[model samples]
Target: MSNGWNHTAKIESLSFECGFCNNKVASDIGFFNNNNIDGLRARIRICPHCSKPTFFLGSKKLPDISPGNDVKSVPEEVHALYQEARNCISISAYTASVLISRKLLMNIAVSQGAKENLRFIEYVDFLAENGFVPPNGRGWVDHIRKKGNEATHEISLMDRDDATELVTFSEMLLKFIFEFPASVPALPSA
Candidate 1:
């Protein structure tokens, strides 16, 4: 009944198609749990048509939920970068998102003691080398980074196309970080 994630569900107000029955059914049963280390887990019965089972687990945490494992599972710097990248995209600030993505990539590189030089192409290359991004994504990263540079320097205006691209890149970066946090090495001393 409890998996450790906070959730609120009203059984009477819930209705969904049953996956198993392939028919509409009222959601009469609700289960909610708040997972402290991760996020929320909820299970609800929608219809007899689909009266199977539903599970939802929010957030990813270290295996076993141990404090030390959790700490070692995801670096704070990487999480911060993810948050900033998400914020920039949510606000439709594509240029800002691109810049922040660059910073995140750079931070990962520096943490691994890799090259610290700041260049669009180099940034993509570093991301690829560190396995934080797909090898073919280099071109896309370079494109966004260049676009961000022009906008930041006032050489070009932030356009919808650029903004959309930046958002996509941010999303991809966030997914990568979530899947492979260890790939982002620790940052070097400033």
Candidate 2:
């Protein structure tokens, strides 16, 4: 079949988790090329669910579309918000990702016993003052608040870098507050 690359090769099909639609799909080969001498291969597959294309060099997908690593031992509600923020980045929804990252901080604070209904900045302060925000991480955590405010109050769009930073900081914060604490063995009974 003819493609934009003007290459002729047998069409192939493969099953993968579609990054665009987040579905397991059997996709048709949209394009393919191989260099036998060096064993390099490039391919594009059309996701049946989203009708979008995923590019692969050899077996690795380009622009990795997976969300950030899951934080162990997070509260169920907090984990959901974290996943939402991470998923937004996977789909290039940077603004939504940043917004969700902001919310995730509040959720984390509340789950860790901070009172709800306080001002947004208060939630950040709660995290910082209570030792949830890592040492030297105040700057990074504050960046999320500032970026989130800009995305919320101003006429501007959050970009991929902004979203990635916010989400990554959130991941580290979650690990510090929930996962690491959960891993510590309990002291022997007094």
Candidate 3:
């Protein structure tokens, strides 16, 4: 014997029956289809008294959401840093460019699994190890870090040529940081 409620089928719609007037009321309730493996399940409410369905309430389908592959892709934030560094270079603000490049490198380093509060020397080491910067470029990084420090700390005069050189170095470093991922292998067990 098959009961009326035995079959689990997707409810297409529902209506209401008024107990007092003994009249069938077509409810405006909505129904949503939950498409699952067993069958489609509907979200709806029924009037208890008259044992009649009422109100076609809105329905929703289960979304097939998943994490995107871009998470594993190169970080786009690095590109923004590159642009800022490039802009600083274009304006002949070499000191500013160098500072921005350092920031960009730090960002890249962290994204590549560097720990927080990494020292400047450690950053230079990582860059050199990853071939992101030349070993001799340590001086450049040091100079920029010092210039940045001076710009922030001391009231020293900054020359245009210095700024221009800083910008050039920043551009070189930025290029290296952005392109190094393609050449390097994935991070190993540390």
Candidate 4:
């Protein structure tokens, strides 16, 4: 078969995970000649559905967060989830961001000793009851909760504004739980 590059070669559809829509897709990339003409390779580096370019990744590295930031003391799993949520937001995956933010909240609560096997609402209650989250945080948390619920149980997609708001709240929650406490200096014994 022939494609965009105008070459006769056997083209195969490759599956891709798109960052933009947070969906998996298959695309037929066009074949191209190797740098030294030693071999041929297919280069379908764009997602057909979203029209966003995709990477032929060999590996992924964790994004850098500044050393002095509160993210350092954050538990590994929670931090990972939070970063992924941000990644989704960056790529306009608002629905995924909302959902991931909700997951981040649950992870925070659990890390702070909230009980397991509780609903997301119960997790909110647990966080409040245990003071893992501040009184001021309740409203934002609830906002994220409801939005995430809509994204979860309903056929809805959050907008950029909503995702940004929720992600900002999630960042604040992380700092409140991890960064603020670590900034205090210990008092000398009398």
Q: Against the true structure, whose TM-score is highest?
A: 2
Tell how far residue 29 is off in model 1, in angstroms. Answer: 30
Model 4 lDDT per residue over 1-190, tens place: 2333445344466675665555677867544333312243424355678766554323321121111122657889998988887777655577998898888888888899988888989998888878877778788888889998999999987987787788788888898898789777988999
**In model 3, which range of ten residues has the least summed lDDT?**
62-71
lDDT of 3 at 61: 20
Off by over 4 Å in 4: 1-70
Q: Quote the RMSD, in angstroms, for model 4.
A: 10.6
Question: Which residue pairs in candidate 2 have backbone atoms (N, alpha carbon, C) closer than 3 angstroms, thus clashing?
Answer: none
Q: Name the candidate that leads on lDDT.
A: 2
Count of clashing residue pairs in every prediction: 12, 0, 10, 0
Error of 1 at 52 (Å): 36
Across 27-54, the per-residue lDDT of candidate 3 in tens digits comes to 4343434443235354443433444433
**For each candidate, what is the lDDT?**
0.54, 0.82, 0.53, 0.71
The TM-score of candidate 2 is 0.71
Tell me the lDDT of model 2 at 33. 61
Q: Tell me the deviation in Å of residue 189 in model 4.
A: 3.3
